[model samples]
Target: MTAVVNEQTSYLSDRQCFAILDRASEDLQNGLALRAFLASIALAALRPEEARVLRVRDVELVDDGTGWLMVHPQAQERREKDSDRAGTVRRVPVCRELAAILQEETTRRDLGPDDAIFVLDNGRPLTAQVYRKVWQQARAAALQAHELDSPLGRHVSALRDARIAAWLRNGDQTAGHILAVAECAGMSAPRLAERFANCLRKPTRDEIPWDRLEAALALPEPSQSTSTARRP
Candidate 1:
């Protein structure tokens, strides 16, 4: 007979999720290293080890016009799975909130393409161990301040799990979505479902304010308005 292991786990609540992000954001503002680390996880969806290898060139604003950030894993050699094959790259269209955060950090640090995006106070690159320690400290501080119930306690691994959970809950039910998130996080989809099944919630359709949309579309079209005004 084969032995069986039950390894199911519960998911963090919405309040707990917000508390964690809130705490991480606070810690990020205190220093460049912490901010870069937090951005790696929250925005780039990078694992701690992968984040450790991130250079300034790995990330870029998608276009001069769009406020979206693009994460290119190709710059980091360690992220490559096969020695013969180049590392995979993907573009993540970040929301304005995350874009603003990156903008501030980039400006504050004067980051360049060839520089290491994350570095220690002594101007050294962040190591995997140090990244974990900093994440733990931030988690502990957040928990102590809010007294929130975190299923994974004060572990950086929990943040990865939470990101997967959030992605699944966002109505990304396709295998491609699951696989992409799993691959980026260096985990299997079955493993993710096993660990975060409880966190999967049905997506709710949010009501769009049509009035606001109409008002935005109603803004004058300069070329058309001018042409019409000059019509004979």
Candidate 2:
């Protein structure tokens, strides 16, 4: 939502995230597109690399809004940073919106299990470079001048931060989901915190005790510093 922000280098505001989604959707309807799916997984809290190499078979899009991606950190041919987890697989639940978009993409292309979900204009697999370029274009088109160059969220990976941050917004319950989200994202819980801690929501106006704060602040005049003349 550009209304709240145009973060060029950090996580997106909800409105900006949705705007990108809306733009991606429009682009997808125009023809074969990757940006929409990109937005989908961004909302789903996936790293760019993870989403980049996803296979159709790895994702199951059901008629309902829920879906999940099975991530393999280790596979000689294709892999993620956590691929060395002794061939372990992690499943990350995705919202229905993302599942629906992916379903459409797979169905439209008649993709099989091993087929890469996204491809480049040249029909090669979607690489980070290709996706980055496309994201720049999409962001510029979707955002206004101020947001175009700020840490507000310029890159696609910022979506992961945004999504994770969104989860952390649930307040105390945030801690409970870190391990699960980390597993899904192929990173450890601490790493997840390091990367997306700032995404956590701050206290709202109502949550602040402004009256007490003001009363406390209003109380007293500052005492003057004691004279430090040498007593020699």
Candidate 3:
């Protein structure tokens, strides 16, 4: 389906994002379909198509506790989307928390690099249709009715939208950032910005520079003599 331009203004808050991720990451009993889907989008800003087709080979985990997911043409036999064009690639970083989760899954299945990262009971790659169904069920479990109805994480793509919007609001939306996100989303910078405007409202607690705020307070308070010097 074609996108509904400006159709949503309520992207996931940090709290909501965590709420969803935490639930999805709970256990393999319920299944990793939603867990992998949520982690792929929430952690890396991967589009639905890109995330669904992700293979173990595309994941690069560093010994230094950082990792990245590769979204590119090599993941497929045929071009899946614009970003899948020959020579086009985006390396989406995976945070420590998400990395640990992925590592656990990889170890559990003893998967080779060529295997699918997110799989099913029979150990098959998840299709987009199944991913969306799992997403809805997971959302119902993780979110309240109002939140579920809201644009926040409404579609799988919204996770990518929310992550990029958070980056922008956190004051990291430089040209380089825009270009990187544009590559991942397969859209121009302006288009990406316009679509995610709603999610770029007030900064979240994570975005605030608490260290800077504390540093300002650490400055010595004015003494009576110092105050007198400034008097008219």
Candidate 4:
């Protein structure tokens, strides 16, 4: 799938992202599958199409939290019969939390190598409408009134943006690191940087001098004060 880049894309904070994931996994029907499906995108930055076709054999879970995914390339066109490259795979590391959840799900379901990791309780494949409805319910349950109305966590893709933002803000920003992260997210390094440039910028509030900030709230100097705004 082509990467979608929008300057106005909204992101969820780590807390809010996990809160919604937890609600989806714990409160909704087929919650376990919902959690795994969303976590693949939110935690590992896998595209929805890639995750939809994920098989048990593609996952490599380790006890030391060093698990990784072997993501088969998704077809470029919706009507395409096969992926552009049939056997090529992209690797993505899995977080400890996601690993644990996946472990539990696999064990409980007794899935085979060819079995889809994420499916409905009745063994039916998951559909977009199903997951979207589940996500909306989880978001409503997890967010505050103001947050619900705002753009925060408003779309499923925002979860992937939130993950990439985390890497930019919390991890190394070196060129090599950027390339690695972009590859893992199935995007080009330049596109990733372009799309997430706002994440790389330092917060303006952090650079403001304390005294200057305080002065802005206090009376201005005589020469600097406008006549109409001068204090008594």
Candidate 5:
């Protein structure tokens, strides 16, 4: 059975997420690697452990559109005992933004098929202890003081939660759509629905404050302004 996700899980907004990543890149050593590592979770909805086990060969990057990542089950644990363990893999779509970072990462070291993607400058695997420290520093640099104390962007897993929420919000709430999202996220459809019930609606485009809309809304009365602009 799948683990239950908390319905009230905290998530970072897109702007906040990108800001943190940019800070990580700018402020930390091995910053680009850290940024790519965190971005895989935020953009591709990968679990931290799953992201850890990613190899260069597992990714298929496309410059124009979406790419792909083949995620194995229980990746970190399974890889310990058997590196070649094979079964049905979950294919998560990689957006163009993440593809650029990953491409840079692979090309930086000319990584082989078996080379681990995220590593320290010393070529050591990025350990949880080390990354946790780096994450704290990045958060300190990017987030406001109050947000540092709050649940928002608190843990690395929150990135995955935010990505899943985006998937839920952008897609139809039909059974088929939910199942597809669950497959990519390595969860059951029922579990996904129960956890993210609040995110199943389409975004409101009409609510956006475009320039014309803002101008129309902010138009002064005829007595206040001689120029009459057409309504948007």
Candidate 6:
């Protein structure tokens, strides 16, 4: 029965899933943009484009609530004419613990409504290729940590897969949450579900491993030199 269940579900073990999330979060905390990008996608189930376009203004806390991190879409048309990208404005409620990080990041930068949230140290917007490379590096680190072999590391969408997994595991089984996420990501809900349903399962609080998250926060702050070095 155990084997049957394992074969039938084919889901990543809880520990493995948490490890991936943990590593990604650590990367983000360490000021690794690519890692942070991948981690956000994994935690929020956002599209790569959406993650890349996220600016300080895009995130908000609803009614001063600590549990949600609203993610608004980017105003791409205004930023670049002839750019066919359109963003959907949506609110995402995150773990209350993430509030400080959100606050610090927003205040740390000089971002306008149209500015790209994530950027290179040179002040250039993070291109898809650059983000993709960071994702590759993160995947390699994750695989090496686990001593596992995976060809999926080469795929940029893998981080999205990880996000879907986290979402589903967190109890977003109904289409409501997924739809909300997709709309915020500027994509159709049906399309997201159709392509990524397998990763969507019921969510549980334990799925997030908040204990591990708290520990990561306890680590020392990065030196100003190192921290400021990544800034544009």
Over 4 Å off in model 3, which ranges? 1-8, 25-30, 73-87, 198-232
| Candidate 4 lDDT score at position 227 | 60
Every model's Cα RMSD, please?
15.5, 9.9, 11.7, 13.1, 15.6, 22.3
What ranking of all candidate models by TM-score puts the best one first? 4, 5, 3, 2, 1, 6
lDDT of 1 by residue, 1-232 (tens): 1111134543444455445556655554335557556655655455565556556665555554334333444444444433222355545555555556666666767878777666765677666676566566666765544333434545565554556566666755667877665655545567665665665554455645677888999977679878899989
Greater TM-score among 4 and 6 belongs to 4
Greater TM-score among 2 and 5 belongs to 5
Q: Model 2: per-residue lDDT, tens digit, 176-207?
A: 66676666666667766766656455668998
Cα-based TM-score, every candidate? 0.60, 0.69, 0.69, 0.76, 0.76, 0.55
lDDT of 2 at 139: 79
lDDT of 3 by residue, 11-122 (tens): 6666766666666655454466567567777777777767767888988999987798787644442453333344567677888977887788888779898887777757
Whole-model lDDT, model 1 = 0.56
The residue-by-residue lDDT of candidate 4 on 40-99, one tens digit each, is 888887777788888899999886976999998766523343322344688899889878
Cα lDDT of all candidates, in order? 0.56, 0.66, 0.69, 0.79, 0.78, 0.54
Off by over 4 Å in 5: 1-7, 62-65, 75-87, 202-232
**Error in Å for residue 149 of model 6:** 3.7
TM-score of decoy 3: 0.69
Clashing pairs in 1: none
Residue range 53-111, candidate 6, lDDT tens digits: 77665666655645444455555433543322344345665544455455545555655
- Model 5 global lDDT (CA atoms, 0 to 1): 0.78
Q: Compared to the true structure, candidate 5 yields what TM-score? A: 0.76
* Residue-level error in angstroms, candidate 1, position 205: 22
> What TM-score would you give candidate 2 relative to the actual structure?
0.69
Q: In terms of TM-score, which candidate is stronger, 3 or 6?
A: 3
